[model samples]
Target chain A: MWSATDPRFGFWLPLALLCLATGFWLTDRKDSRKRLASVTLFASLALIVFFGANTRGGDTSETALLAVLLHMLGPVALMAIGSLIATFSGPTPVGPLPRGLRPLGFSMAIGGLIWIGLMLIEEPPDAIANGIGETIWGAWVEVFLSILILVATLAGAFCIMMGDERHKEAFTLTILTISAGLMFFEIMHNGSDGLEATGWYQIHWQQMVFLIGGLLGIILAFIAFIALVYMAERRAPDPDVVAPLTEEEKSVVDAVLRLNLELEEVEE
Target chain B: MSEKKDAWWGPIALLMLLIAFSMNLFVWQLSGGVEFSSIIDRMVTGFSLAFGITSFALLFVSLGAVHKHMRWQEQILGLFGCAYLGIKCYGWVGNGFDSISEDAVILLAGLTAMLAAVGLVFGLLLALVTGREHIPDLLLEMDSTDGDVAVELED
Candidate 1:
């Protein structure tokens, strides 16, 4: 009973085409299959754009699209590009990025962060239906505050433990910790536009639980994997003992060692 | 040396306990100075949802790995597993298919992916900055036993 004319078909069609394209692209190594994948990908994208433009309420679709691109994609893309440049433009360049570009990279990265901060404060897309902008800004604030608290706490603890030499650092960290903690309390009490204080508190606790659970799960999984590997290795029989190296093998080893030692000496 | 290390354990344990107790008290006070039941329920729900999402994502990834092996039976099973998990994710989000708008669902997925990407990028950037980009090589070096290295040198 499903037909192309169905209202939902527009959404489903592009998704199906995308999935098909991905499958072909991943599974096939041949050129023809790659061509087919490219074609399907383009077709899916074209369909998505066409349907997006022709939605029941065209203005809403356009607004949503603008909001997503501006609020979500733009900042992310800027951050990623900026971070990549900055990372590779260091004194020890990771790739082809010139060290001379470090300043530019830093500017871009900071610009991206400022954009995000401005978006949070301004709530430019808050008028969008479903309050997507508010939700995103709330999530960002929670994460930012969490990170600030965590970093400040850890740094404060470390500085305090480092004896008199780091007393100033410890004092600064304590101030930062207190400030972050206060900010967290303030946000939880006052809440944001579409969400109440109680709701914010609920979300904060939920996220804490989620974060703790995730960390524990990852740690446990890693421990389990390591234990399993150890057990499997233990079950394996020991390798047969090998005879001592022959004169030729010894000579070869000595030659390689000598070459390495000579190279080390030269480098020194 | 061992004794010195052991000497720190008592203090560390006491510190941890103190922190935990203080946190518990804080949470109790925050929960309207009421009984702990509501806070516990919230925590339980959060933990369950976290584990559920993690388990489903892991299952999907493992199934994708199976599919890559190109075994028909396993691939078919993986397809079914993926479909079931996809349905479960939808249910978790909206209770049913019709309850959530298509655009909202898409936005949620997109946001999740974007956040994950951001985390990944930052992590990689940290690694680069910390000169840990040769971690793969370090792991390979760790995996090579002394005897194996000797044998390789001889060969």
Candidate 2:
């Protein structure tokens, strides 16, 4: 008897799916830059899936099944799209891979399945009780997913910094902002009794903090990724490495001529 | 070979740790919820006081390092110590001193102290590893080689 016309259920379900789909498409683009959109895209999909599943289906409905299906579709497709972009964009040199990061990614996928399974089995805690009866198992799923996203983002930032030092400052600052957002969210989620008691909870600016910061981070990371691909594609061949000045190099030589003359006079 | 073993701050951190440990113990000792407000106020003050003391010390260390008189190694040591103290203080304060179950506080305090202690131990290990690199030079170098003993800044 769940009405498609019910604003609470009807609105949130497709809105969440739209966010996920948008993330999926951006990550699916041919451009290497779009592939760098991976973390936000992945995180958004996971969150959307979770929110969608919880809302429309009360643990046992066909709606939960459909939400899981969409969840699987978005992330896996994006992952494939990212790999393809990385491969086809030429041999872009990346930084050292973070320890246990790929495994974390795989673990998050497994955790997602477990989360859906849990939702299917038990009803979510009521609004008033809030975190009542959130099992250690459920908490672990959330923690694992958060950590997975963080590590993956760090790995991506590392690759961008190695490929282009100029973008390093911007990329790192973006990373810091995203990390701060996650940290703030965690702190609030852990306990925000003061805010809740003071009645600021209903305003829910916390979600805005997560969304805005995450969007900005996604944009910066995308720019850095594309820059890496550009460097990789335009890199000189091995033969060109030892060869004498090309036209581009000769222009630099002419510019340095005055400086060389000045150095000669100083030596004399 | 210089004896620089004065952990005056250790007692301070330990005091905060004890407060965190004892608050819950004392709360439980008194049987539950006789009067909530006075208990809540005392708990709040105790937690805030711990946080303030530790953070104040950290601020002093940070400020001291801006001047030339403080050695770089001392600054590093101070930072690690400050982090330890800060963790204990924040843990006590943030957990809402007396609101939760005493059993929960016990576990929380134990975890907080264990993590801080581990960090402290790791810092000691780091000191041992890098001590070899600096000790020889430090032993050979006289304090007066720079010829002027500068007083710490008045800030």
Candidate 3:
């Protein structure tokens, strides 16, 4: 029977797909095929992040799901933002052939490292009630770490947007989507209370609606990304094969070629 | 090219900044025990800003690609279709989020609907993203380029 503690699709599905998506991505060689695999991996990771947020962590006062989710926000936000920043502002490719893949690899490596480190910390999962009961200092530690990660992530995004043109649109979009999802989550979480006070409470449905909506937003964004990549890859060969006169066509073709080059640049 | 290469990170960094900003904002609320409405307002604004920008990015990327492929008119049509779907999905999600009242049936129904929607969206997006290239006939056309359009089949 379904209950409040019922496992979320957010948690299970993303984890399961993570394996499949990564496998496919790693196995695929064709540019188009690789793109599809990468997108799948990206989408799965995002979903994992979303669902992870709802699970409890090894601390107390909130559901373990929620705490774990919160815990994840720290590392993910930090790395994502850091990676983005590195994308635009970091040291120029020093010893690399294709520069783009290096940053991606570096970021992935860092993420894996952090995950391992956190596990080694052996932090026990804590419920909300436990968190509330903990001493002020303990709470402060959590808050401080969380803040540090948040700051790093935001800074990464800001630097990237302000400095580079290629990824500005992508960074802007990701930031916006995350912000929107947060707002929806917070609003519905609180609005139910207000409605209850007014004697017209309808909370359960609200959660469902908001979560579903957020998920859809995530899916659409993923689709848009895939389309962008496909278009870029597909348009790559035209400039090499066909001669064009119009400056506009040249520029468009150049853009496509650049993207193709970037894709090819990824090391592994 | 250096600048272009570096530019992609801007959004990701900004996302981190926002997360920090929002967390601090929330911490301020929790620490001070501020009124719920204030927190809600902040949260809403944050969500709007984040999601709105994301939507814009999605639109830009999608449109850019579509314009490259189909005519401008077709690109616009495609954009419109995506937007329509997004809006419709938003409404459905909003309804589910808001439907969690004391009514057991409504709650149950809402949960089911939300789960289904999330799964559908997640699964479809995954499949589409991983299989997007296969969706286009462009590559198939290009296969001949290797054998060369110069190869006149004696058929």
Compare the candidates by DockQ and give the number of the best one: 1
Model 2: residues >4 Å from true position, as ranges? A1-34, A37-53, A56-268, B1-8, B30-155
TM-score of 2: 0.20
Between prediction 2 and prediction 3, which has the larger TM-score?
3
lDDT of 3: 0.40
TM-scores for every predicted model: 0.51, 0.20, 0.22
lDDT of 3 by residue, A1-268 (tens): 5332333355434444554455455432643544666676688677655554544443222234335334444544544444443443333444323435534533542453255234323433444223322211122223223333443344434444555342533343344335334433343234222122111111212222233333344555556646745665665545455554699988999999999999889854
Candidate 2 lDDT tens digits, B1-155: 22333434354445445643443343344333234454443344334333333333333333322333323344444434443553454456445433222222222222232232233222222222222222266556656546667779988
Tens-digit lDDT track of model 2 for A1-268: 7554343344334434444344344432554434434554465456545555455433322233233334334433433333333232322244423433433433443333334333423433332113211221122222223333343344334434334333533343344335434443443344232223112121122211122232333343344334433554455344434667889989998879978999999999
- Which consecutive 10 residues in model 2 chain B have the weakest lDDT in total? B99-108
Interface RMSD (Å), each candidate?
7.7, 25.0, 19.8
Worst 10 residues of 3 chain A by lDDT: A193-202
**Cα deviation in Å at residue A111, candidate 1?**
3.7
Q: Which of the two, 2 or 3, has more DockQ? A: 3
Compared with the real two-chain complex, what DockQ does model 2 have?
0.01
Give the chain B TM-score achieved by candidate 1. 0.39
List residue ranges in candidate 3 displaced over 4 A.
A1-26, A29-63, A66-206, A239-268, B1-155
Candidate order by lDDT, decreasing, is 1, 3, 2
